[model samples]
Every structure is written in structure tokens, then in C-alpha cells.
Target: MLRPVTRYADDLSYVHHTGFADLARGAARFVVDLIGPERRRVVDLGCGSGIVLRALTDAGHEAIGVDLSPAMLALAKRTAPRARLLQGSLYRVPLPSTDLILAIGEPLNYLEPDARPPALAAFFRKVARALPRGGRFLFDVIVDAPGRPLSRRAWAAGEDWAVLVDTTEDAARTRLTRDVTSFVRRGRRWRRTRELHHVRVLRTVDLRRLLRDAGFAVRVRTSYGEHPLAERRRAFLCTKR
Candidate 1:
């Protein structure tokens, strides 16, 4: 059986300090500018908790989000009751014409190797099928250089857990190896769970190639937020043909 593409059982508040809401809003504004004001129809692929969806809507765009996790979509609905939210995979989203598609938060890197290409292909086909002559897709990805020392690392406070961080050899992939350490709580209980993920490290070259194959003219810019594209993290700007 295939693994469900979405997972949102835990509280997303864990990653709150990552500034998901602010970052998504900034990215949305950038996409709208690149795609133009007239094209206001947008979709948020892998929209977690509908943060990006909320951001897009606040910017006066007709934005909806599609996520694989029903739990996450439920949270999203609670967060943005007016925004249209869908529970589905990126590989299979049912919708009509859209002017812009945004997928951020390094969501693309979470796909397994074999599932990566096909997922991208399907998403591209959907976007192309929906878009007119000049539409755009903006997404972000993380790159990992295997065997490299940790650049930025942090632990979830109040838990005896350490999050191991490393990028794969290709510099396009990253893995968040969760190292679970146990500590007694109130001298009564213990908690532990190890979450290891082997996700794709999408490379710029391969990503561009895939976009071209999917009928997109790709332009790799450092994020619109002015972050430099390095061996770790960055964003891509793609215009569908």
C-alpha cells in the first residue's frame, strides 16, 4: 500500500518559531507580483493549517489550499473559515483554471524518490491544464550536503528530544532525523518516539529539467524575501507554458 502523502497528527505549534505565517505571506505577495494583479486565482499546494491560504486571501486573491491530511485541513478550516480548503494529494487535485500555484515550506523535499517525479509531473499537468498562456508556479525546496556539519540546530524544549539535521549528498535533499532521548516526567512516566524521514533533495538542475518537461519555463531566484540560495534552502519561480 502507498503511504499517505500528508501527515498532520501532531500540533503544528511545534514549528511556530519558524515564522510560517509571515514567510508565507511574503512569498504570496511576491508570487502575485510576478504573475500580475489580473491573475488572482491561486492555489496553495501542501498548505498546512491554511496559514499560506489565509495570507493569500488577505492579499485579495482567490486562494484555496489542498492538503493530504484531513486533520490539517480541519485545523485550516478552523483557522480560515472563509477560505476554500480541500483534502487531497498534490498528485491528485480536482480543480479548474488557476493563475498561480504556490507550494512552500520545503514541502517538495518530503516526497520519496520514486514518488517525487510523478508528483511533480502531475502537479505540473494540473497547473498547466488550469493556467492560460502565462501562469506561474512558485515553490520552495531544501538542499542537503551529506556528511556536512550542522549549520543551524535546535531542540524542542520541555522534551528530551534532539532533532538531527543533515542534507543528502546531492545538495538538493535533506533529512530531519529525529533522535529520541528519554527522561522521567514527574517520576511517573516516560515518552519517546523516533521519526526518521528519507525525503528527496531536489536539485536545481533536476528541478528545472522537470519543470521544462512539465511545460514550464523556470527561473531560480533567491527567495523573494532576499534569502540567498545555497546548499541548504531556497525558492524557485516557474512560469507555465
Candidate 2:
């Protein structure tokens, strides 16, 4: 077998789009409300499969989406045809000047470069430079909280696709790993794809300090408003002030 890809592929993206859709669907209302009826330019980093892009466009925002996975961007194109979809990493992408930036789904956590706090600190500076005073940087980060599980296995299935994931969290090292295998039905045959994802457990305190250093006023919350994110995932609303 080939070495597991580090990012989402076709089958894996499809599985997530179909099976874990509650994450995107549940986030729609709360995120939209954060837009506050303004027709602002919104850039979505790691805009997977475009569910939130569709929501942003439907709400009249000029939405630009960036992701490293072409497979995920393909689905996102169909999901939000009106939104401009760019294939690029959030860490390396040329982010456009925008009134608001959305990095929902913990997009900042999974990329390998973010293994260090300085990488994320540089990213925050970039985001700060890409926005003007009063602009918003709304995103979430996964923290290594106390009493969290060390390792876990989970699975999700749909009519034509299934996903199995083995997750390992190391608190001492501040890392999270997911070994994911996806099986998708293709013309009466099942195709399997595997990918490994790693997330750095960047602390909220460090991230808040970085945001503040980058000229943002940061607030941490468990939810956007009504939609409580999965455990340990905390949202940050950073306004350039």
C-alpha cells in the first residue's frame, strides 16, 4: 500500500461531506449571525467541501475559500459555485484583504507547519496584515484539556461511503493524531483510501496572546452562540483594534 497521504483525498472528503455534515450544518446559523447582516468580504481558510461557503454566499457575503486539498475544493465548488474557491494551504496561501476571515473546523490545527506556536503566530500576523482595523478573525482551535481521552476509535457510515478513524492524543507532547480510512462504493466495488491527520494542541492562552500581539482583541468561547462546538474546540473572535 502507498504511504498514507497527509491530507484529505477524494473518498475521504466525500465521506466527511456526507457523514459528518452536522458539523457544517450546525454551524451555519451561528456563523451567519456573526456576519451581522453585513455584506462583507469573507475568506474561509480550509474551506472544506464548501458547506460554509454556500452559507456565506447565500447570506450575501463575497466569499473566497482556500484549501490545500483539491478533492475537498472540488466538492466545495459544487457546493458554492458563486464563491471563489482557491486551492492552497491556509499557512501558505495569499490571503486577500477581507472584512472578515473564517477558519472554522479547526483548519489552523491540522496542518503540519503549525506544530510550533511560532508558525501560528506568524500566521496570525499575516491575517492581521490582511485585514483592517475593526476587521474580524473568527476561528476555532482544539485545546488539550484536562481529563481528555488518550486514544479512541470511531467510525461513521453513509449509504455509499464509510470512514474509520483511530485517534490518539498526547497531552504531554500536545499533539493529536487521526489515522483515517475511507471506503467508498464505486460501480459495485468498494474503494479504500487512507490518510493521516495530525493536529497540534496549541493552548488557548498562547493563541490569545498571539492574537493580541498581532493587534487583535480576542475572546474565547465554547460556541459561536447557539451551536456548541465539539468538546475541547474553542472559538475565538479576534477583532483588529
Query: Whole-model Cα lDDT per candidate?
Result: 0.61, 0.83
Q: Which stretches of candidate 1 lie over 4 Å from their true place?
A: 1-6, 13-22, 35-39, 112-119, 144-153, 156-194, 226-231
Task: Give the per-residue lDDT digits (tens) of candidate 2, residues 147-217.
Answer: 56647998888899988899998848487788898999999999997888877777787888889999999
- TM-scores of the models, in the order given: 0.73, 0.93
Which pairs clash inside model 1?
Answer: 144-167, 146-168, 172-201, 172-202, 173-201
User: How accurate locally is residue 184 in candidate 2, as Cα lDDT from 0 to 100?
Assistant: 99
Q: Count the backbone clashes (under 3 Å) in each candidate.
A: 5, 0
TM-score of 2: 0.93
Cα displacement (angstroms), candidate 2, residue 92, comes to 1.3
Could you give candidate 1's per-residue lDDT for residues 8-110 as a string of tens digits? 4433322332333556656655765665545387888888777767766666778788877676777778776768988777767676678877787766766
Residue-level lDDT for 102 in candidate 2: 86
